[model samples]
Target: MTALPQERRIVTAIPGPKSQELQARRTAAVAQGVGSVLPVFTARAGGGIIEDVDGNRLIDFGSGIAVTSVGASAEAVVRRAAAQLADFTHTCFMVTPYEGYVEVAEALAELTPGDHAKKSALFNSGAEAVENAVKVARAHTKRQAVVVFDHGYHGRTNLTMALTSKNMPYKHGFGPFAPEVYRVPVAYGYRWPTGPQNAGPEAAAQAIDQITKQVGPDNVAAIIIEPLLGEGGFIEPAKGFLPAIRDFAAANGIVFVADEIQSGFCRTGQWFACEDEGIVPDLITTAKGIAGGLPLAAVTGRAEIMDAAHAGGLGGTYGGNPVACAGALGAIETMRDLDLNARAKAIEVTMKARLTAMAEKFEVIGDVRGRGAMIAIELVKDRTTKEPAPEATAALAKACHQEGLLVLTCGTYGNVLRFLPPLVIGEDLLNEGLDIIEQAFARI
Candidate 1:
C-alpha cells in the first residue's frame, strides 16, 4: 500500500459527504450499543494522520485508543503479519502449537517487570487476560474475593464489569455481575477529599483498613489496580500509594495484579507504568499496544502462580492466533529498534510543557497530569470549586474535530481530554495537534 501524506488537509467539512453516507449505512447495520468517537470513515492511517474516505487528512491524537503506538500500519508489523498470513492462518495453539506463539510468550516473559522466573499465557484481548489472571489467582490461593479500586476500568466482560467502577456505559443494567468482587479507594490526588498532600498515605490506610475489616485479608484472592488509572481520568496514584498497597498485599498473602493494558508498551516511558513505583506485581496483564493493531493480550507472572491452573483449565479456541503472534514479534522489534521508551519520554516533556502553559492561561483546565504519551487534562467549571465541566469537554473535542484533529474525551464524569498520539508520530504533527487544541479551547 502506498503511503498517505503525513500533513493534515481538509478538503471538505469534518465528516464530509462520503463519511456521512457511510455513517448512515453504519447506523442501519451496526449495533446501537457500539460507539465511535468520530463519524468520519478512514481510508488509511499511519504515522500521525488518518485520511478519511472524503480525502480529508486529520492528525491522530487517539491512536485507536492507545493501541497503535508503533503507528497503525508499522512496516515491520505489516510485513511480518503478511508473511504469516501467506504461510498459514491457524492450527489452534492448544491443539497444535506454533513457534510464533511461543516466541511472543518468551518476549513477554522477558519484558514484563520482575526478574523472577516468569511464564505467560496469551489471549485475544485485555479483558480475557484480566479474567484469566483472576482465575489463576483464585486457583493459586484457593481464595474467594478480589479487590479493585474506585474509577478503575478492567473491561466490559461480566467479571470485569463487576471489577470496573463506572456504571453508566460499562455496567448499567448489565449486572447482576460476578460475585466476590470488592471495591476500594484509589489515591486520586486531584479528587481526594482530604487534599493532595495527604491523599497517598491516608487513602492507602483507608483501603487497607477497609479490606481487612470487610473482606478479611486471608480471604482475598487478589488485589488488582492500574499503576496509573486510565479510564478513570488518567489519575496517577499519589506517590508511595502503590508501594503501600503492594506491601499490604504481600503481608496478607493476596496476589497483586497490575492491569497495565492501557498503561503498558512504552506508553508511560517505562516498559510498564508499575516500574515507576518499583512495585512488582505477581501478575501483569497487557494488551492494547502489544501487537501493532492486531488483537492479542497476555497474562505474565510468576511461574508457580501461572502454573497453578490444571492442564486443560485455561485457553480459548482463538487465543494466541499465529497471525497476531507474528505481529507481536514485529512490534517488539520495532519498539527496540526505535527505542520507543525514550521517544515516549521526549513526547512527555513536549506535552507537559505545552499543557502546563495552557493551564496557566485557561482556568477551565483544572488539572494537568499523566506521564509520557498517555496525558490528560481535567476540565472544571472553576479552579476553586472544581466542579466537573463535561459539556465544555465535549464542546472542546467537537471543536478539535471540526479543525482536522482527532481528540478523545474520557473520565468517570466525561470531563477529561486525553491525548494518545502514536509514539512514532513526528514532532511537527504533535505540535500541530496541540495548536489545534489551544485553538479549540479559545473557541469554546
Candidate 2:
C-alpha cells in the first residue's frame, strides 16, 4: 500500500529555531571550512522522510546522494547491525581476519556481475576503492599510464583528483595532481562535440582516436569510467559508446575499470550499470550504498588483476572495519531479498512518466535522463538553444524544499535537478514529491 505524506509543517522559518542556534554554534566550533547542503538539521529519518530538529518532516528525494537505497532507519538494517554490535567490534582484517569480512567478500564476488572466478578487496570509502583499483591495474598490466573519461568523479584524494575532471569544487586548490593520469571525452548526448544526433559511437570513436594519437595506447594501463556518469550530469552514454570502449580496452590490453561508486548497488536498476551494457569490466569500484549508511567500499575484479597487488600494499588500518563489514553483509542480503534492482526499475518508470510530462509542461526543462532510481532532469533556458538554466533550477529546488520535498542539484553548469529516492519509497509519497516538483515548475 502506498503511503501519503503526513503534512507540510513548516513550524518556523527555513532554518527553524533549533537549526539556527546549532548553525551559529557549528560556525564557532567546527572548521569553517566545509559547509552544509540543507540548513535544517536532521533529528530522525524513517522510510522516505527526514524529521528535522524543529520536528518538521520533509520528504527525502536525495537518499543521502544515493547511499541509503533501502531507506533511512530501515528495520532490517537496524536489527542486523544491532545483533552484530552485541558480538564484538574490531579485529583488523589485516592482522586477524574475521569471518564477517570474508563473508562480505564472498557475497561481493558472487553478486558482482560476472561468471568468472573473482576476488574482492575491502576499503573504507569510494575513493579508496578507486585508488586500489588503479594500483591493482598498474600491478597487473605493469604499466603506469591510466586513462579516465571527462566529467567522471573518482574521489578527492590526490590521485583521484587528477583522475576527476571537475575543477572548482574538487580540484581547485589542490594542485600538482598525480602523474600518468589521462582524460578523454564521454558520450554526452545533450551537447556532444558533434550534435546530439551524431553523439553515438562516433563520438566515442573520436575520443579513442585522440587517446591513441596523443597518449599512445601502448603505454596505457587502464581506462576508468562510470557506467552512468554520476556527477557529470547523470548523462547516459550513447547506445554503442560503452561497447566500443570495452572492445577498445580489450584489444589494446588496457584494463577496463568501472567506477560504480554512484551507479552500483541497484541504483541503476541493476547490480551495476555495466550489467545493462553487458560489459564486464576488469575492475569494478563500488561504495555509496554498499553498506547501507555505513562507510565501506570495495574493488572486485578478475582474480589475476586483484592478486597483482602486493600482500601489504592494498590495506588501510581501518579498511574493513567489522561493524562496516557486518553492515555490508546485511545490506547485500536485504538487497537480494527486497529485489532492489526491480525496485530501481519501478522507480525509474514512475519518474520517467511524470518527469516527461513535466518537461512537456515547462520550457525550462531541457532533458530528462537516467538509468533507474538514479535519475536527473536538466534545466535549460530554451529547448531550441539548450542554454542551461542554473538560476531556474536553483529556484525550483528552493521552492520544493520550502514545500517539504528535498531534491538535489548537480551538473557542470549546475542546471540539473537529480532525483535519487530510496528504492523502498512508497508510490504515494513518490507521486506527492513529483506533484511538488510540478507545482514548483508551475510557479516558474
Candidate 3:
C-alpha cells in the first residue's frame, strides 16, 4: 500500500552506509541483550518487501517473524487503526472499557476452534497470554503442575521460559523460573528415536507415562503445546499424536492448551494448526499475526473455564488497547475478505514442491517439513546420523541476506531454516525468494 516497489534490489552492500551508521548508533544506544537478526534499518515495508534506509529493497521472507500475514500495512488494517488512533489510543480497558476490545474478543470466539460457548481475555503478548492461560487452568483444575514438551519454545517471560525447553539464549542467565513446570518428549518425527511411523504413539505413551509416574497426572493443571511446534523447528507433530495427548488430558481433567502464537491466524493454512487434526483445545493462546504487527495476544477458551478466574485475577494495564483491537478487527476482516487460508495452502503447495526438489538435490537438507507458509528445512551434515549443520544453516541465511532476501533460522539445535513469507506475497516474489535460497544452497 506504500507504493514501494514489490521487488528485491540490492543497491549497495547488505548493511549499506546508512544502515552501518545506524548499527553503530544502535551499538551505542541499545542494550547489548537486545538482538537483531538483520541490521538494516527499514524506512518502509509492505507486500513482501522491506525498503531499508539505504534504498535497498529486500524481499521479505520472514514477514516480521509471521506477524504481518496480511502484509505490514494492509489497507483495512491501516485505515481502521488510523481511525481508532484519531478516536482514542488507550483507555486502559480495565478502567474504561471500549467496544473495540469486546469486538476483538467476539472475533476470537468465532475464529478460534470449538463451537462450545467460548470467552476470550485479551493481553499484550503471547507470553502473557500463555501465563494467564496457565493461571486459568490452575484455577479451574485446582492443580499445580503444567506439562510442556522437549524443543518447545513458549516465550521470554519467567513462567514461559520454564515452559520453554531451549536453554541457551532464552534461559541461560534467567534463573529461578516459576516452579511446577514439567517437560516431556515431543513427537518430533524426523529426530525421534523410533521411526516416524511409530513416533506418534510412542512419544505420546512416554509423555503420558512421565506425567503419571513422575509428575502425577492428578497434580497436572494443564498440558500446553504448539499444535505445530513454532520456534522448535516448525515441527508438525506426528499424526495421531495430538489427539492421543488431547484424549489423555481430557481423561485426566487437565486442560489442553494450544499455544498457537506462531502457527495460528492462517499461517498454517488453517485458522489454527490444531484444526488440522480437528483437535479443539480447551484453552488456546494466540498473538503474533492477530493485529497486523500491533502487539496483542489472547486466551480464548470454554466459557466455564475462562470464567473460573475471579473478577480481578486476569488483566493488565495495556491489555487489549483499543488501537491494537482495531487493528485485529481489520486483520480478521482482511483475512476473510481475501481468503488467506487458501493463499497459505497455495504457498505450502508451491514451497513444498520446490523445497522437496531441493532436498532431492542437496544432501545437506535432512528434512523438509511444516504446513502452509510456516515451513522449514532442517540442515544436517550426514543424512544417516542427522548431525545438525548449524554452521551451514547460519551461512545459508547470511548468503540469502546478502542476496537481498530476508530469511530466518530457528530450531532447538539452531539448524532449521524457516520460511514464513506473507500469505499475500505474489507468486513471482515467492518464487524469487525460493530462487535466492536455492542459489544460496548451491553456493554453500
Candidate 4:
C-alpha cells in the first residue's frame, strides 16, 4: 500500500517547471500574507520524503513545523481518518455531541503531565486552544491581565499576537491588540544579557519582580510560556527556570499555562515538554502533533479551572470534528505503539552529535540547543560578537534545497536552523539530510 518512496531524488531544479508554474498560479490565488518556507508544491509525502509536483523527492528535516511527527501519511492516522470519513466528516460537536471528542479528552487527561484531576476542551487550532486557555484562566481567577515571556510564540490570533514578542512578521501592522498582556524576559541562554550560568534563576527572579511591581500579581490571571520555543526559535529556557516560574505562579495564585503546541506529543522525547522540567502547568494548550497531520487542538488543565468556564462558553462549531478526533486517537496509538518518545530521544542524540561537530568547524553556529527531535543551531556573523547571520542562514537553506533536502530557518532574529524530523524517519535518511546540511554549510 505504500506508494511513495522514501528517498531523495531530484529530477529537475529545486522548484522545477511544474512547481514554478504552480507557484505562479499560487501567487495570484493565495494571499501574500500567508507565507510558505519553500515554493515547491507537494504531490505526495511519506516517511522522510516530500515529493514535489516535478517528481523531485526531498528529505524532510522539518516535520511540517512539528505537525506531522508520526509521518505525513501515517498508516494509523490515514486509516482512522478515512474510516471516519466514510461514515461522517462533520456534524459539529456543539450541535451534535460525539463520543470521539470525549475519547480524545480522556486520552489527553491520561497523557498530559499530571496525575491530578484534569479536563480538556478541544478546539480547531493551536491559537484557539491558547485563547481558550486564557479565557478559562481569567474565568477561574477573575483577573484580566496575563503575563508572557519574550521569545515565546503562542499563536496568531489577536490575543496571541499581543502575547507574542516578534513584531515584524506576526504583528507588524495589525495593532490595537487585546489589552492586559504583559511581557517578561525568558532564560534564553545564548542571548541572555548577563550570561548562561545565571540566566535561569536571574530571569525567574526578574520576571516575578516585574509582575509584582508592574502588573500586580493579584490582578494577573495567568503566566504563559512555551517549554520549548518554536517560531521565536527553538530556545529552551535554561535549567530551573520553568520550575522557578511555576512556583511563583502557584504562590501568587495565578494560573500557569504551558504552550506545548509545537513541543508536545512525543516531539521533545516526552508526551509533553513540561515533563522535561517536572513542571505541571495549571493549563496546557496543545495542537500540531496531536492529530498527526489533521487539524485539532485542546486546552488540558486542572479540573476545577477548566470546569470554571460556563458550559455554553467553550463549545465551537467545528471544534473537535469527529474525523479529526478519530485521527487524534490514531495518532496517539501510533505514538505509543511505535515508542516514538524513545525514537525522538535517539534523534536528539544523533542530531546533537552532528550539529555540535558542525558548530566546532563552523563559526557561523553560535549555539546549538534543544531536546529530543526538536534541535536547532543559532547562526551568528561573529563568534565573539554573537551578531545574528540571517543572510547566511537563508543562503544555507537555499543550498540545502538545491541538493534535495528540505530545511527550515527561524528565530526572532531569523538566524536559527531548526530540525523536526518525523519520528518514523529512517536513520539512513536522517544522516543523509545531515550530510546535505554539512555540504551546504561548506559551500555557503
Q: What is the lDDT of residue 8 in candidate 1?
A: 92
* lDDT (C-alpha) at residue 33 in model 3: 96
Model 4 alpha-carbon miss at residue 292, Å: 0.9
Q: What is the C-alpha lDDT of each candidate?
A: 0.95, 0.87, 0.95, 0.93
Q: Compose the digit string of candidate 3's lDDT tens values, residues 256-335.
A: 99999999999999999999999999999999999999999999999999999999899999999999999999999989
Where does model 3 exceed 4 Å of error? none
Candidate 2, residues 208-246: lDDT per residue as tens digits? 998899899989998999989888789898878988999
RMSD of each predicted structure: 1.0, 1.8, 0.7, 0.9
TM-score of each candidate? 0.99, 0.97, 0.99, 0.99
- Cα lDDT tens digits, model 4, 321-346, are 99999999999999999999999999
Model 1 misplaced stretches (Cα beyond 4 Å): none
- What clash pairs does model 1 have? none
Candidate ordering by lDDT (highest first):
3, 1, 4, 2
Question: Considering summed lDDT, which 10 consecutive residues are worst modelled in model 4?
Answer: 1-10
Model 2, stretches more than 4 Å misplaced? 1-9
